[model samples]
Target: MILKYSNFEKSAFLTEKKFFLFYGPNFGKIESCITILKSKLNSLDRTLKFLNLFQDDFLRHSFTEIVNQNDQDDIFGNKTSLIFSLSDLRVSSEIIKLITSQDLNIQNIIFKTGPIQKGLKIRKFFEDSPDCLIVPCYEDSLLEKKEVIMRVFENENIEISLDHKNLLASLLSSERLNLLNELNKLIIYIKTTKKNISNALSILIDNNSHDLNNLVYLLASKKRNDFWNEFLKLQQTFSDEIKFINIFSKHLEKILFVKDKILLGLTPLNAMKSLRPPIFFKEEETFLSQIDLWNFQNLRKAIKELHLCQMSILNNEKSSKSRFLTLITKILDL
Candidate 1:
């Protein structure tokens, strides 16, 4: 059986089947679902034992050993809730065989994997199995995100205006963990201060705009020392490296557009004027100066470097802060 993320509930895990598969790009949601399942299982069977094992551990240990581990009887009985975070799904055949055998009496077996392709044998095995369920976790839509934010705020007895809620939703990342982290920060802020839209915006948005704008200005104008200073300050204020990369990419793209116009025989001043969204009057002079300082080649190189930095951040989150700082230093040199 297959389940959509929204439709998943703890009751689903109570079926006669012991095996469950949760797979998708949204690891946060998958983990939350697993928590709910575990909580529900524990409530129903207090004596049930919980075991967590990685795929490598499972593969390294003999099948008999795994079965024996699961089959171990406590003072009460031999019931174990097993969770396997699969590092690789290519061994799905062996996993499926082990889970299907009636000889081993495991209470519940949960398998989790990162995004699986549609044609993968492992995905098909779980989806097609009558005795197991596959739950797909996808990114939440904007409306869903808004609902989550509203629910969180409401639970805390904090009332947010629709516009403020929308703004918060726009600022939040689609990933649940990041979103929750931001929400927790905002909730704490609200609890400590005046809980109005103005206060919320002041707490969340006001501090970020100046630093971000200054960082963009410094990078575009090729002020190495100032850019590094602004970058450090912005990093302190905003911990989301991906969001910074996104803002940097947009600014670089704008510069690229202006550079293209300048290449087509337009003066930097005229090119800034020609910008579609129209540069702010106050920033137009600085924008034009940036256009004159950066050429198409440099702008393109910066964009590519920023993109690679973004990919690195996503792939290896642990070193993202250092990676981003290094990227800025490299771009400054470029």
Candidate 2:
């Protein structure tokens, strides 16, 4: 019933199971889940068929073609597995109806919905299905953490020791994949240094790891900012450009309204974080704090601006009209 982001695939959904949904923005994650399902069901015959859906040209079927198969027996597992990369729930609903009408006795139907909640209805359908099993693939946490550390370690292998602060800086710049790569690089670095002593290696590793962990807080901030920037972009696309302008207008209005309300005696860092439009004053913080502030009015405005800029880029309309970028630059002084 309840599925974490990582182990959703490994759980039991194969063999006579009713319905299954492999929904998420991570294509890699959904693909991995589908691979596991295929292996479990011994559906090697249809591997090429599944791959065709991903290809541009082969994917010409409507929502009905996915759930309805010519081979009735394969409809259960050999072909019962309905894999959809569509994010539209209404479309998913139509497929579900087709599956019911065809009476495939399907073992599992893998629906890869992007990272959006609009697919909740599709999720609920599986949850409500009597014999169905619902599994959702989300972000993997431990792997992500390991990746962050590995990336920095690869580029800057600390043989002796490293300043905790500078080490943190490198980690901040590194993405999750970069961390794992860096960790392997560190192993190579250690081998080159010929430091066989366990104690020295332990100390070196601990020092770097500690700094990396500390930098996670910084990374968290950047993550929140990045999310905010993205949210603004999405909002602009879905909503009006003026909607963002109004949000920014309202936030500044609120800040001016509540400027004297909050005790300004607090530190700027703390104070800004507490404010309605608190300063995300650093580029590092802006990118790192991508997820911290979401669904906020000010964040909406920021995202809208970003969306506008992206549209401009797509249209090849060059101009200094990126209000979102301008606001971010001004806020962060970058």
Candidate 3:
């Protein structure tokens, strides 16, 4: 039977079916489903021993060997979960032959593949079979991605604001493993530094060098000479100007947030200190200098213009660093 990715659950796998097919372009989620299925199966029957096979090695003889095999492999009567990954229709005839020949004794075989169009007989065969279930693993939705970010942060006791959480959800890799890898780096960085994920986040998202974060943090400083000196060193590292604008704009928003908060009964330092996923300890001096440099109103205006500049750069493909130069001149002059 066909199973939708959205509808898949532990209960769905709790069945008499012995064969399964998980196919999709989203390989990360395909692995995730496989992990879930194995965990559920293991809960019912412990110490599952997995046998890994490829499409090339799979044959009728291989199937026969699996069928004839006893539980001598492990003392726990290990359930065999044959994982045929990166599969295609070439192995379908063998599977069909085995199904037609007799009942499948090995109940944990799974086939994982890339996208299978409707014309593929293998997908159809699994769909039609009572003992087989085919599920499509697809990319995650925006809301789903956001939920992952929230869950990860909540688990770490690292609080993130709604705005940042949304931005991260938007910016992060859609693939489950890649997304988790990025989040893992962020977790480590946050724990070690006891600081914000902004720098690490910017680096990961843009594929930029870690030190470029220093340049971004420096942009908001009142010390123009220091910024210009460091700007030259890091200018070549600005591989993606759009990403730079994104990080820089976000930095400004951080200051703008503090500036806005200052309108209340809080001091600039207090407002900066209050930021969750706290500002980097080393960057605190520059962050405070930013608060003293620009008023809330101008900083807000500058941030908006920076975003507009980003759009202009995106639209005007011919534009160079000159545009950033012009924008920075205007901002520093402010």
Candidate 4:
């Protein structure tokens, strides 16, 4: 069975099925769904055990070992609920076979994955299976984003004006998790300081804005020392490496766009002017310097490196600061 985000709540309790596949690009929504499912399972049977197994761990260990471990019943003799965070869907055949085995001891198997392309065998298997459900999560629309912002603020008892709400919606990235984090930051600031939205924006939003832009500028201009300095400052200001990577990625995309324009016979100056959000007058010279330093090829390569750096950060959160800095240094060298 396939479910839409809106209908998930109505069907969330259909736990009779043994396999559930939550696959899509909207990681935030996927996580939210997982939380709801876990809550439901706990409510249904408090004694039910929960097992978290990543795809890598599953592949590294013998399949028999996983089955045996999960097969062990709780003190109440109830089977454990296995939550599989799948990085690759190619191993779906093995997973499907295990779940379908008549003697399997798992209460439920929840499989979470990134976007799965069409015609993939695993996707097809889930779609065709009577025992599995497939839920696809795409990016939220503008109305959905607004509703989230309003609901989050309302829950926090932080009353925001409609205009401010719209402004925040615009300022926030499309990624729901990032938007939620920013909203949490806003709520905390409001509760702690009793500050208005304007003050919150100044302190929370504008204060560190220049640091990321400056850091990207430094990287584009190949200012190794300055890049390191700004990177350190931004790290100190913002703790989330993923957020930093998102900002860096957006700036790289802008640079790529400008590079493309230049390639299409437009002067660098003309390309810069054509940017949607016009470059700040003060930063124009720096932007031009970066344009001179990086061509289209170099920008593409840098974007790829940034993506790898983001994955490294996500995979290893503890050492992300150092890992991200190293990647920035490498990009500067390139």
Model 2: residues >4 Å from true position, as ranges?
5-10, 43-59, 73-82, 105-108, 142-144, 147-334
Encode model 3's per-residue lDDT on 1-334: one tens digit a residue: 8888767774555456677888865677898778877777777777777777776665544655654463244565566767777556665676677765664567577778887878577778888988788887865656778888999999998888898887787666566666777778789988998778776666655654455576677677745787789877654333346666787888888888888788887988899998888998987887888777878778778888888778876665335446777888788778
The C-alpha RMSD of each candidate to the native structure, in angstroms, is 7.3, 13.8, 13.2, 9.1
The model with the greater lDDT, 2 or 4, is 4
**If ranked by lDDT, best first, what sequence of candidates would result?**
4, 1, 3, 2
Query: What ranges in model 1 sit over 4 Å off?
Result: 10-14, 194-197, 206-266, 270-334
lDDT of 1 by residue, 201-230 (tens): 775675666667777778777799887776
lDDT of 1 at 223: 94
lDDT of 1: 0.76
TM-scores of the models, in the given order? Answer: 0.67, 0.43, 0.57, 0.63
lDDT per residue (tens digit) for residues 19-68 in model 2:
55666544445666667776766653543234224323225755555445
Ranking 1 against 3 by TM-score, winner: 1
Could you tell me how far off, in angstroms, the CA of residue 26 lies in candidate 1 after the best superposition? Answer: 1.8
Worst 10 residues of 2 by lDDT: 235-244
Q: Write the per-residue lDDT of candidate 4 for residues 201-227, one digit (tens) a residue.
A: 777566566666676677777888877
Please give the lDDT score at residue 64 for candidate 3. 52
